[model samples]
Target: MAEQASPEAKYQLGTPENKQFLDEQRESLMAFGHRFPSPGGSSYWLGDDGTPWTDRNRETWITCRMTHVYSLGVLVGHPGAAELVDAGLKGLRGELHDDANGGWYPAVTPTGDYTPDKQAYAHAFVLLAASSATLIGRPGAQELLDDAEEIFLKYFWDAHEGLSVDTWNTEFTELDPYRGLNANMHSVEAFLAVADVTGDEGWRDRAGRIIAHVTKWASENEWRIPEHFTSDWKPALEFNRDKPDDQFKPYGATPGHGIEWARLITQYALSAKIDEAEKQRLVDIAEHLFARAVADGWNADGAPGIVYTTDWEGKPVVHDRMHWTLAEAINTSSTLARVTGKDVYLNWYSTFLQYLDANVIDHKNGSWFHQLDCENKLMTTVWPGKSDLYHATQSMMIPLRDPSLSISVATKEG
Candidate 1:
């Protein structure tokens, strides 16, 4: 067993290391703004020297990504959040309108590459942010909303396969078109956000189509999503399979994606709540995920909560550190509680939240550790403690609303 941390240690002002994560972000964002220029920019940049910036970095690392901040806006309308809305909306618009290709590039790396994968992930953010902006009556968000819808509908949607791509192959030398649960799940999330934000009948109709595609995939595949597929939705055989044989299952069989599928189905359920038949459809998906996750990979006392993969019959294997899975579990379970009016989801969420607060949260740092054993113990790793980007990067969004937990106690990231 590992040494237990005191509540004060766990709950007090977090490690100084955590503060540096955001400081680096704040400072780098500051630097990125002035040194790099883009076709469009927002006002949130500070410099590497922490100076004020006049230029744009298209990515707008700190400001646009302030999911925590945006969550803050959602939960309490924090002062900083209210101040940044216009700027955030503008950045979302610029990102959407970017490139002649009809979708936005991912971001500006240090070398200042546009890196236009035109990913569904960032576009998902576009949906969420635009929705939030519209909620607050921000002026420019409507056009951004239109831009997001157009790109998703025209560029990424694959009618035959019934899924969306993580990104396009246009920029790469060899054409390697791909679709994955991660991207398409994000597309589902984006559509849901837009539908809720606009409250338009058309948005809801579109959201239903996307959700149905996702549900069809999950329904046919044991409530698990494959990691990669061709544009037409055939599995990408022998592509990313060198790890461990058992680990190859859900891809042929994997556990992490079950959590993601659950998360999407959870959102789809919540999005489909207004109509009785739609709500029933979503409920079926949610129950299937819960039942499937329980059957395939969950351990009542395991560290990962779910196994990474199973045989063709659905079994758990290769219990490891998967941040995305864990994050999805937390969010999906929590959302299920909210949507179903069932106390069970809340109870499950509370249990998961307690575990996370005790483990993965890295009160010593700003972000999360990637993995641990299935029993909630930390694992030593080259990628241990802090990661620049991952699904857990946004985990704090929900927890921040829990004041007694001290997520807002200012451990890391300013």
Candidate 2:
């Protein structure tokens, strides 16, 4: 757990120096990700110095993230952001899409091999990208959103359970029995963006349903939400136990996700037209989730950063610190502070900002380092090069904006 520190002048969330730091970081991220687009419009994985890692496959999810980021860029008046968003939309509507099969492929290899499977994860990002681009009035974004919504409702979303399915085959004929919270978490994010941009209140209600199920599960499991699940949605606590460091699906509780969920839940609670009592209850749940994540993950290994994963009993599993986890922590803490008027969360926000400045941020290079070991030295075992600018870019901007709306909508309104 973090020892609360007094807020300093520069690290406080709304201070002039803090705003200047965020602006500079946002600009750097925009420049760093400028070279992400390939000829076909799919995103190229960026290396340490912001060069495109041409040998790696171009992933649809990465492209969607870049699309969403640049859309925010357009909202914030970044130059050439519209062109970048159009490039991402071109990829989404063209080469990466399965024209015949109807949904998106996970990735396209440099040699032109298409990775199979229609993933809920990738589709969720597609929806997010489309929703954000639509907000910025990008061409073809509404059509992309319509198609993404239809495909998600047809294949990924399980309306009966108020939850979503994990994956389907390329032809959309067979469904994978594996269920996961990771996709659903992002779906909550996408759903909120859809609701905000399209004025579809149903999407917000659907997101609330998913949140209800998650909060119940987390409450029963001592606030550590389970990640993997069986076909029937039973918690498969031992799914990846043998290989705990598997990139996407790890073995146990992911504290980063807990923190991320807290922020999303708060957003939903604030945005929904619910009664005051209900809103307070949801905010309480968000606070608990944030506290649990910070207590279990932050400095759990006698180190300064949040661990990537933890056991069911809240013990540290993977000691590596992911950049995205810290990003979510900073966003959630700032969000909690704003909604609750609590100085403790502000203290945590200051602490995270200080840690980010001192260690995680690549001061020489444009973007932050993707991973660090227990000793705070750079490590590439889990996340090699910086994949995309989605998380890092939002981390810099989210704290300065309102928490009730999605990042895209918040950027527009703020």
Candidate 3:
């Protein structure tokens, strides 16, 4: 990733420098855009404890944020973002496909050591990444996408149930493994993205089934879709307790649950093919998530982002106060407002954006800081200077308004 270069003499841009930067960097960026994903799976050799990220773990956050960037960057198409955009696209090409297994591996370090963890959820990321790369007409990225499709359909695709699973062992020894709504929804997203590009009806048809399954779960259950489950779609609450919030049963309300639950509306709003009543149901669900998040998770003084998790009592227990959640809220609420032509959603989003712009954006760093403490301070006690180019990259996942305007460039020192 470009972040490897470190903060060099504060190479920066903003309103005043717009013309100058577009003149200088635009040609360079547009010249070789969509090269690869950033921080491109380099070996950090340090653990989350700050010792070492091990060769394999380095790809985790980097890949995670790439998924975010690919989702949002296609339309944003901001001037300076093209560099990281190129890196992110190229990174996907680097960390994919192996003859040993039918599909791709997790990631590859800069030195070219391959890690063994291959998750379909991650491949789902490629559905978006490859689509973005293809949209931008990045060279040889089609091959990367082809490999992604091969592995994903080969390993994760379940024809009978019609959904992608969470992970697949490279050897193809285990099939029908753990399943979750997270991976399934993401797969639907990727599948639809490919459909949009290829005009492929099979992809959309399959995505429809996945969506139907999701909505089916909502109808039969108490809208508390279980996380992981047995082959027959049984509830897997055992792992739920180990999460930050013990017993994060997803029914009435949970921290960030509403925001997350509503994300499907944004993803499929264009093609759910729902009648007015069903569409209203989707809108109602999105609004419900916003309300629960506001009522349970909002910190009166801290502003209006959701918490990490919530309880049946409608209480929020936050472990990490993340910027991305707020970003998603913006995209979701804004999307709902736009699609439904409702002014209230826009009003909520406006206030949320103002709070974030005024308080959270790190002016000196040239991007948004990762998270804030409950006391409404930067979470320096945890990881100092942990700001990432991809945190901002990830924020752009939903295609924001005037991405250039929202982005903060390091001010050039006189």
Top lDDT hit: 2
lDDT of each: 0.51, 0.94, 0.52
Candidate 2 lDDT over residue span 1-414, tens digit each: 457556566688889989998888889899889999999999999999899999999999999999999999999999989999999999999999999989999999999889999999999999999999999888999999999999999999899999999999999999999999999999999999999999999899989989999999999999999999999999999899998888899989999999999999999999999999999999999999999998999998888999999999999989899999999999999999999998889889999999999998898887999999999999998889999999999999999998999999999998
The residue pairs found clashing in candidate 2 are none
The C-alpha TM-scores of every prediction are 0.67, 0.99, 0.72
Model 3 lDDT at residue 33: 24
Model 3 sits at a Cα RMSD from the real structure of 9.1
Q: Which candidate comes out best when scored by TM-score? A: 2
- Candidate 2 deviates by what RMSD? 0.9
TM-score of 2: 0.99
Model 3 regions more than 4 Å off? 1-56, 60-90, 109-112, 216-225, 238-240, 245-254, 272-274, 300-304, 380-414
TM-score-based ranking: 2, 3, 1
Sorting all predicted structures by lDDT, with the top scorer first, yields 2, 3, 1
Q: On residues 16-67, what C-alpha lDDT tens digit does candidate 3 reach at each position?
A: 3323422332233222223223355322322222233333334533453443
